[model samples]
Target: MKELRYLNKYFKKYWFKLLIGIIITIIARVFSLVLPPYVNKSIRAVEGYVASGSGDLSAVKGELLEYILIILGAALLSGFFTFLMRQTIINVSRYIEYDLKNEIYDHYQRLNLGFYKQNRTGDLMNRISEDVNQVRLYCGPAIMYSIQTLTLFFCLVPIMFIKAPTLALYTLLPLPILSVLIYRISRVIHKRSTIVQQFLSTLSTFTQESFSGISVIKAYGLEPKTNANLQTLAIEGKDKSMDLARVNAWFSPLMILLIGISNIFVIYIGGKQYIDGQIESMGIIAEFIIYVNMLTWPVAVVGWLTSIVQRAEASQKRINEFLHVQPEIKNEIDKDTPIAGRIEFKNVTFTYPDTNITALRNISFTVKEGETVAFIGRIGSGKSTILDLVARLYDINSGELLIDGMPIKKLNLKNLRGAIGAVPQDAFLFSDTISNNIRFGKENASMEEIVTMAKKAVVHENITGFTKGYDTVLGERGITLSGGQKQRVSIARALLKDPQIYLFDDCLSAVDTETEEEILNNLKQASKNKTTLIVSHRVSSAKNADKIIVLEDGQILQEGTHDQLVGREGYYKELYQHQLSEN
Candidate 1:
């Protein structure tokens, strides 16, 4: 219930419609009560007519026809108002559902990268889709039925007591027991519902991962193992669903049993009172029977409404768990601050939040506003991590990371990241057209500009060779393209951005040596006055940089020009000799 309080603002937003719906529900219940009173009157009329020697029955026949018409009109009005009630309240629920999803999505966008690392994509999707759907049931059907149930009780039960208090008392004796049953059953439902939702998230994550890695599964010949795993998850999910269903099964039968007990009280007591001449006629008993039946459906639905509410609360609690989390990175400044790209890491130390792995330790370096610096190192030498810091995908632990002489954290996060064009070692592209993928860097980029950037990245020829040319649609993650072509497309995307700084993290690793040489020449012409950072294991990529920094195990091993490093006897020199001999 506390978690569900989050939706109070929405209730306020649509209060007028809810008020109308409540009025309509009450009117509908009132209309339905008309039939029982008419039944009582008709039966009394018949008793009187029969007592009048059963002659000259024309007056009685006309009166009976008139009563039937009134009953029919009341039934029609009740049905119409019931439809209106559903339309208003149910539509409000849909509106609330739409707003809730948008709020969750916007909050998701605000969350930092670390959050995504800790959560699975499928689980996130489930919260937004499946969990929200369950909550909608509570908002719409649960609320509507609850109102209808209450309206019937308030409008009909009082009349029963006014007419026959003793009979009413006996009839309602089973209700308190029914209430206790509902309370106990609802507790079980809440517990089982939480477990079921967790199972859904687990199953969703497994299936998503399987689909995304289908290629890897096939290549490794693990289809049988994957199938077996999925089957196991499905069985477990089914068992959990059955557990919830078993609890729900108690509700309807319990409602029916209690309603039956109430009817027995009505018949036995009404019959006894009539025999004692304490009741005037069978008409009173007939009226009481009609009232009891009118209440039957609404009471039966109480169990269902409780189930819906319990399940909704369970799902909403899960949603609130993520919604309440404040993002680790906050935008302190409200205005955008322009970037100049003079990046300096003053004794920087950084550790990844999720794994607590220290990627950089007391690292210090400076890249001038328009200098191309190359970092060459073995694996785990903190080469790519340098680019990540420059983009502020993560904030450093204990260091002064300055951009253009100001603390990077003080700068507007969006503006700082916007000024840099980064190409990661893993080139990711969406499932879209080739032109659209390139245009992602610059949303309004023209076809001519796209062609120019593609040519500069040495990928335009490959694109034009396709039958669809620039319009060719890529598969997921640009799977339609070769590894080298994917890297080139990613490079083309960055080139299209034309930002103040470029961070290329081994993007040319997949390209052939000849193509890599040509692409490097094109990049030299393209990155003339832009600060660029190139991270690669190849000496060739580092040879043309203004300064090459060699790293080993998170620390600088050598820092100098190509000639200076090749002339000296060090790691760079030995690597250079080995590459030269191989070439």
Candidate 2:
């Protein structure tokens, strides 16, 4: 219930609709209450006529027909209001469900990369889908049913007591005992429902991962192993669900047994009262029977409502865990600040949050506006980390990081990121058409612009060779294309952005030297008058840059023009010599 308090705002949001629904619910119950009394009158009319022993069948028939018509009219009106009650209240719940899912999705977009590294994709999906759905049940069906039950009890109970106090008292005796049993059973249900929800998340996670990595599983010939593992998880999930079902099974029969006892008390006690003339007529006994049975469904539904609420509370708790987390990175400035791409890092140090590995140490560099600087290094040499820092993906542990002479954090994050076109080391493409994938970098880009950028990245030929050309849809992560083709497509995507700062992180690693040289030439032209940082291992990739920095073990080792470094006897000259020999 404490967790469920979070939904108060939504309830407040749709308060008017809920109020109308409540009014309608009460009115419907009142009309439904008309049936039992009218039934009593119809029975009494027959009894009085029989006692009179008069020759007047037409009078009795007319009176009986009037009562029957009134009963039918009340039933029709009650049914109509009940329908409106659901339309008003249940629709509000759906509206809340829509709002909640959007809220969760927006929060997901704001969360930092570190949060994703610590969480599983399947669990995230489950929270938005399964968990949110559970909460919806609480918002709609559980709430609606609870209201219906309460209204029925309040309206029906008093009438029974006023008609025959002794009989009503005995008939309601089982209710208190039913309540105590529900409380005890509900505790067990809450515990079991939590366990079932958790197992569902685990199962969803396992299934999602298996499908996403199906290629890896097949390639490694581990299909049997994967199948066996999934079977194990499925078995565990089934056992947990059954545990919950077994407890729920108790609710229906328990309700029936208790309500049946109330019915028996009605028969035995109401008969005695009628025989002793304490009751007016057999109609009172008949009315009491109808009222007691009316209570049966609502009382029976209590267990279901409790189960829904318990499941919802568990799901909301999971949603709140992520909702409460503040993003690791936030923009200090809200206003849009234009970027000129003068990136500077002074004594910057950075550590990866998830792994606790220091990726950069006292790294220092500057790329003035419109300068093309290339960073060449061995693997894990902090080349990519420099690019990440400039993009403000992670703040440094110690030192100044500036973009356009402003502290990186002081610039609006959206404006700063928008001004940069970054092609990461591992080129990732969504499961979409090639044209749409390129258009992702610039949403409103024209078809001609996409083809132009694709040509510049040296992937145009491969794309046109396909049957659908740019219209060809790709598989997951662009697995449909070759590695070189994927990298070229990613390059085309960045080029389409046409940003002030271009960061190409070893994007040509898979291409042959001939194609690499051609792409480099095209990039050199496309990136004119823009600050560019190319992080690559190949000498040919960096040789034409205005300035080249050699990095080793999280620190810069050399900074010079390609000719200057090639003339000297260090890593650059050795690499140039080695590559020159291979060529």
Candidate 3:
């Protein structure tokens, strides 16, 4: 019920159009109501002629022609108003849908990485596409028909009572039973529809994950197994859909049966009164039958219309839940303070959401302005997590993180992120031209700058080898290129930004030893005056750094230059000896 209130905001925005549409709908129904009364009038005249034993048909013909023309004109007006009503209301529904979609998309952009980790991509996609469409259905045809049905009911009921009150009572007696049946069925329908939607989301999520990992599936020769898994999800979704459909099957026909019973009562009671000579004319019976027939369709659709309304309410609730979630990180209104490329971590600790393990603990360190530092540790040693914190991807659980002596939390998000150039562990690329992917780092970067950065990152020669060169369009996730090529392009993009600070999270892992040495040599010259932090597994990468911090189990186990740590009796010495022996 509360979720239905979300539509009130959209309704207010297009109230004028909605008001006009309702008025036109009422006018159309009223015109339709007029034709039934004319039918009653014509029949009564014919009855009178038969009773008086007059065979003259001239008067009847004249009256019939006059009323026929009137009814025809009324029919024309009714159709024109109906067209106007649909045009206004349906167009308003589309506009409201557009606004709602944009609102949801914008909210998604503001959410942090932690939120994304907890929710699946396909579920979010379904919420925006399918769920939004459900609400739009309620806004358009459902509202139009509901207004039309109610207007006709109010107009027809009074006339029916005036013609024959006792007959009217008999005709309406079955309606209360129909009402109760619809009310009970609607609750079940709502529950079943929600389950169907949730299963649809699960299916979407499974399909997306499967396709994204199709290469791995094929590599392992898992086609049959993968297909079986997909089929399992598909069947689950189908079962939910069948459950909802089964409920709807019982709803429509039952409503029609009730309406049929109401019609039978009208005919029996009116005929009995006529036979007893208590009714004035048989024409009233004809009019009553016409009115009851008119009421039949609207009455029958009560369950169907209620199904639409219930589905919309369920969808609105889902959208509302997503929109109302407050992001863990909020952008602050920070004072203008110049970033000096200095980072300080003071006894910081962080634990990921919904997890008991601490990812980083008591990790006190400082990277002074214009210094190059490297972190060498095993997998899951908080190396990437530390870089993630620098970007403020997730806030620290305790202690202070500072950028140029100012608390990182108090800094403007845009300003802070703008000062750093980051190359994540996964070298993600958009499905776009090679040049466009490089230009993403610097929105207004020139072609010459792109080439220069690419050359420095050792990827220019590879780009030139492609048929379209920099104009080549990439496939999804840059699948067109090899892993090492993707890494070089990612490095080139970060270099083009020319930021005050640089963070590379194991970016050179895909490159061979010779190429990695060449790229690192170039980086040494390019990043002389900037603060650079590199997370690497190779001790050779950190041997030249001003400082090397060895992390183990979320704690800083050792901190010194590479030579100072090589002979020490600690985890760093053991790792160095292993790598040295492996080579």
Candidate 4:
């Protein structure tokens, strides 16, 4: 019922079309019902004309012609109505699917990063693709077929009773039995189909993970192992599908049994009536047979609709769950206010959802405008967490973070994000031309500006060396580029944004020393009038910063200029010495 209600939102928007389609279907069914009786009446009239020895041919021919015309008219009406009904259903289904897909996509964009982190890309794809498709199936043929079945049954059953009450009652003896069988089989089908869908989601997830991580698998020589795992998932998916098929196989035979029993009962009773003269003609028996045969579709639809409903229910639940998950970071109250990039953390703390321990505890720092600040720490030292907090990726658990003297909780998220530019460690790239990827940061940026930024990041020469230059299509995640090239492209993207506050989180780690130096020189020149924060492992990366803060276990242990930190003989000094020794 909940699933049906959920589907009704889309249906209601097209309800008028659906209602007209259903009305047309009812008209078609009515025309269909009139056919058997017309044939029966015409046959009886023909019999009477033959029985009477003095029957005039001209008088009988007119009646015969009238019957033929009525039959033709009914057939034509049924055909036209059926066509309109089908067209309406198709239009409604297509429109509903369009709206649903757009809604899901828009919802996804509004979701926070944490929601994406917990969800598998393949599972999300299945919800958008497979699950929505199931819903569409229900919306289109399943809905149309269901309406047609009920309308046919209602129109035929009452007519059956009026024609021969006793015979109609006797003929329907197998219906209850059929209903029980259908109910049981439907339950089994629903259970198995749910399992099948879940297994399919798992299979999709495995395939997506394998393809996305193919390079890593090859690098580690784990292809055979990965292949074995995928084969196992495929086998499991196959088994579930077969099991659902096995359940569905029982449905057709049961329908056949019930339909056959109904036919046999109708023949026995109608034959006796004909012999005893209670029924007047063979045409009446023929008509009854046709009417009984019509019952076949409604009964068969019962089984088929059961499967559609089950699949749609499962899909609805999955989509609803995704839509219901609350974002970890909610938008702030002041949604349009701008900030000047003066950031301060006042005893801010945070813990990830479903975790006991804090990732950042009582962390505090401040960066004034036009200052180049550096955060140095070992792995798992919450350096990245600081950057994430500043970017509003996660909300603080206690205390406050302020930008330009306004609480970050009160600053507009879009404005805050728009004012900051970040180059992350992983250096993610889209499967697009180099120029387009850089333009992602600033959509309306000209080609000339993109080239300038690329040159500043030391990637312009490399990009121009390709056959297509800036138009060269990169592979997924820039797989065609070297690590350093990918890193420089990411830097170029950030630099192109020309935001007020720039964040480089270990952005120079993958490049050679000389290239890193050149990039740093460019960054220094570019960031002279803007506030920049760099998180780096190498001392050289932070050596020229106006202020360097050494973070250990989410707490700032020391803060000073490069010369002071190097001379202080603390964590920063030790890190500097270690890097110099390695070089």
What is each predicted model's overall lDDT from 0 to 1? Answer: 0.91, 0.92, 0.88, 0.86
Q: Where does candidate 4 stray beyond 4 Å?
A: 53-66, 354-357
TM per candidate comes to 0.93, 0.97, 0.90, 0.93
Evaluated against the true structure, the overall lDDT of model 3 is 0.88
Residue-by-residue lDDT tens digits, candidate 1, 67-167: 99999999999999999999999998999999999999989988888899999998999999999999999888888888889988888789989988988
Model 3 root mean square deviation, Cα atoms: 3.0
lDDT, model 1, position 503: 96
Q: What would you estimate as the lDDT of candidate 1?
A: 0.91
User: Candidate 3: misplaced stretches above 4 Å?
Assistant: 44-62, 274-282, 334-338, 444-452, 521-528, 543-546, 560-583
Please, what are the lDDT tens digits per residue for candidate 4 over residues 1-583? Answer: 3865777888888889998988888888888787899889888888888899779888788888898899899899999998998999877888888898888888888787777777888888888889888888889888888888999888888888998887788878888988888778877877777787777788888889988899999999999999899888888888889998888888778888888888888899989988998887988777878888888888877888888888888787788887777665767565487767788999988887644457777978889988899999888788888888889888889989988888887887888889999999999999999999999989999999999999999999999999999999999999989999999999999999989999999999999999999999999998888899999998899999999988887788889999999889789998888889989
Candidate 2: which stretches are off by over 4 Å?
Answer: none
Which candidate's lDDT is highest? 2
Clashes of each: 0, 0, 0, 0
Candidate 2, residue 162: the lDDT equals 80
Q: Which candidate tops TM-score?
A: 2
Q: CA shift at 399, candidate 2, in angstroms? A: 0.3
| Candidate 4 positional error at 384, Å | 0.8
